[model samples]
Target chain A: MATERTRVMGLFDTEGQTASAIRGLRNDGYTLERVHGPIPSHVVADALALPKSRVGWFTLAGGITGFFCGFLLAAFTATRWHLIVGGKPIVALVPFVIVGFEFTILFAVFGNVLGLISQARLPRFGPVTPYDPRLTGHKFGVLASCETARKNDLFRFLEAKGAEIKADEGGQP
Target chain B: MTETALTYQTVDDTVLATLRPPEKSYWIAVALLFAGILMGAGCWLYQILTGIGVGGQNNPVHWGTYLINFVFWVGIAHSGTLISAILHLFRAGWRNPIARAAETMTVFAVCTAGLYPFVHLGRVWMVYYMLPIPSQRTLWPNFTSPLMFDVVAISTYLTVSSLFWYTGMLPDLAIIRDRAKGTRRKIFAILSLGWTGEFEQWRHYTRGYLFFAALATPLVISVHSVVSWDFALGVVPGWHTTIFAPYFVAGAIHSGLAMVITLMIPLRKIFHYEQIITIGVLEMVAKTIVFTGLIVGFAYGTEVFIAWYSHNIVEMETFRWRAFGDYALEYWIMVVCNTVIPLLFLFKGVRTHLKWLFVISIFVNIGMWYERFVIIIGSVAHDFIPHTWGLYRPSLVEFGIMIGSFCLFFFLFVLFVKHLPSVSMTEIKEALPTGGGHGN
Candidate 1:
């Protein structure tokens, strides 16, 4: 195994405290490895300044692909065998639009799901850092990674912002 | 308690506890549902061995109980999307507790509904011929056929809804993984996709959820409309109406809302989620039921009025037969159960009273099933030619399959509640006072 990276986690009960704590950590040149909360909050997100997710573009791309594919498939199959029933035209736009619309939804949803997994970088191999499970329930947790020499400084930094620090010394429980 | 009063920890503890291994009653229910599934499977196998002739399907009445059950199940699946996706978009706060179960119901109901077309096929093995793929035989299913549209629409609905359900559950599953031990922890770890509630993950997850909801909203409307066109595109007097699309969509949501209520009541009791799935939630669902029931009522009345005004002999005769025909008893019962009984929900008392609401929901489900039956069997039994008019009755085999389908639906739901968080943990926590208001 690689040498363990020192990690210190702080649990805060309020979103405002967590936000200020995150800002404090960032201002001091300490990067926040991760922040966990019971819910997604705009206050926290704004504090962290998260990058915009590109899922909508994925959906748009999937929809366009689906639209043309649906129309072409319908058109191609209609003309493939060339069934001359009552001498009607081979490619009918009106009826085929239904298929196109259904596929738009189908593939757009597919793209959205795929975009989530890819963008979130999901199905990760293991826990990314030391995390408190209570953050998922009612509390806000912030994990800060640093050198063992700077661990004491990080602890004082978190405590000043009204947070309870969990000193997970060796990075592993 | 109002959402504003609860803390995040309280919501987390309450919702996560439901994932525990259920009690003896759950096992007993599972066993019963398993038996029903087995019985259904046995009946299906018997049909396969003997032939499709075992069911009550023949010449003019070839579409029988299987199709009726299919439409009913599909309709029952609609409310999941209605509650989860549509309400989410509209930012309905009360939907927080009920959304998970409703979305789960959507997937399983669609699964149950998807089985019927195969069961109706005389040669079940050759059912794959319906696929658009090419085979050794140069045969391709006609995309123009409504049956083909149904296949694509239903499959898409299933895929998208399942994805939506899985996406919402990721955070909850991670919490379970953290709390669990041994084999259970390992399983949830894999299922949770190593979710850590990292800020980036949350960012992408919310975006994906919104887009999923947007995609699913249209699907909820289109899937049932496609199912309706399976009948509407036909030349049959009653089946060919233009209003059938919206009419079917309304009926689908109405029936689906009833099913959600039916499932939620027992679940809330069993899981001790009374605080979360409060009477207030049930009331909201009940009010929607009344609204949808009125739409369905309007559709019913419109159909009758159109039949009277069209002066088309076939349409007029079919309408007359529906009221006083051989299946008139079912028609009247459908009217009473669907249109009249739902009106009781307009009163706050009946809507909030658990026992009365549960009873009314069951009746609504039965009425909705009967409505499909009346629409399907009634029109086919009495068509354009009086001489060819026929009466159809279901055999024990058909009855077995229908019972089996209900068993299958409940069974999947039971399994879901046992394994996953039945209510959304993240959402409920977001609805708490400490968090922001109803974090839509």
Candidate 2:
């Protein structure tokens, strides 16, 4: 026998109300598969208890790389090229320090950007489920995937929390 | 009707309503800017007809007003990027009202700064020689050269900053589009790019914005550092120093923020953004000015110390000449304007008072321009060889061009304010207190 999964979504009148329903479901140990809200709400993330993001760590790594790259470029230009000038030292460490510092900052900033894009899994271009156009304007929704056997219980729980259940028809809800 | 009045009173919507309408002063500013633009164009034509020789560029003093104005414009440009990108990253709410205006200044200032090197070039038509392209003539730009590095750095900075500015304006443009009636609506609709506040769109838009800001913060630092390297990488006594990069960057920010404050004081009054751009924001920016001023002051001290400690007679004499010799008046003026004026900002009363802050900002800008002049022309005027030393004075053409650059800057800013929303409405609305609680 194979376990079956059922997806249920509850539409609420407001962001605050939908957040409450999500919170209630999460407290009862039902994993929230997704959330579609009128606007961004931190409550959904809090209910899910998502782990700390690694974007900062990635930015830090990029910064370090930038610093080293800057240092190397300056060092190489001044020392390896050996462009002697007026009996002054061929490789002046002092002047080259500026380039090194500049490159370090440049690389670090780029790294942070790259990290943010990749980590966010952004530029998403996938098929989106058709939702009420008005939902985006001023409505909130709670979407969750659960065991097929528990569909009736979940429906009852959501209805009890004042969520309006819309029937799924031909893959459209 | 009485109930509605009671609700309005309870809701505290009066503050928004009480915001003064856009006044006649903005029109006067617009007129002045237009005049400036005309003057600048007239001067530029004069420069073109007579040639670069009309301005003050003699032997040994190869760079003059053009380069000084270039650095000044570039320094002024930094404030916008700093306020927009860096403050956004840090989630500084106070940046909401003025970020757009500041970013626009950055773009126009960069455009004006970009013209200087070409104008300085005796053969302006050979400007393409700076680009890395295969041509009939075998003249490849030296990639290692600091001047070449400046070409790359400035172009990159300009490109990135413009992208950042335009992208940031998109959402606000949409707001303006919806609120606008008739022709303005049509214009804004096109600029808004069909933004409908869709969730997925917002997600991508915000992510892209954040990514650009992150990319821009360091680019700002690098661009100025590269500009400093143009001086620092040389064998000149005053120019060749390790500290020049940071010193120049700090000085740039100091001047840039001062310019921003100077512009904003008048704008806030004219645009009726008194409530939005509060005393708190001005104080915060003033603090940044003071901080950068201290860094600049320290760099000055360090330069003197290094000159004396190195025991290089030429270097020591250069420092002496800058401080106590013929240019002593200029040097002391730089110190008084840059260092002493900023010290008044330490007092809360002065910082909070917009009028005082505005006056001080002017002094700071003047001091910063002198600072660049001191570094570039001062060092060149009194170099290692005594017989080669000479004084540089700008001719009428040079003065006209300098004034023209100011006109160009003001012209762009005025047009930007009239056509576009000077304040970021969406960002400002987002920051407004939701339930009558003061937002920190």
**Candidate of highest DockQ:** 1
Q: Model 1 chain B: which ten-residue window has the lowest total lDDT?
A: B431-440
Best by lDDT: 1
Docking class of 1: medium
lDDT for predicted candidate 2 compared with the true structure:
0.72
Candidate 2 per-residue C-alpha lDDT over B1-440 given as tens digits, one digit per residue, 9 for 90 to 100: 22112221221222222222446876787788778767767777778788877888786787888899999889889989889999999999888767877899899999999988877885778899887566777555544568867876787678678777876776556545545567776776677665544433445455556767877887888788889988998988899999988888888889989988998898888655666677788899999899988898999999999999999998999999999877787788888889889989999999999989999999999998888788888899899899999888788888887887888888888777766767665465445443222111
Report lDDT per candidate: 0.87, 0.72
Q: List runs of model 2 lying over 4 Å from the truth.
A: A1-18, A21-173, B1-28, B430-440
lDDT of 1 at B98: 95
- Per-residue error (Å), model 1, residue B303: 0.7
CA deviation > 4 Å runs, candidate 1 = A1-7, A145-153, A168-173, B1-5, B435-440
Per-residue lDDT of candidate 1, residues B182-207 (tens digit) = 88878888988988777788899999
| Native contact share for candidate 1 | 0.59
lDDT of 1 by residue, A48-111 (tens): 9998999888988998988888878777777767776687677877667878888899899888
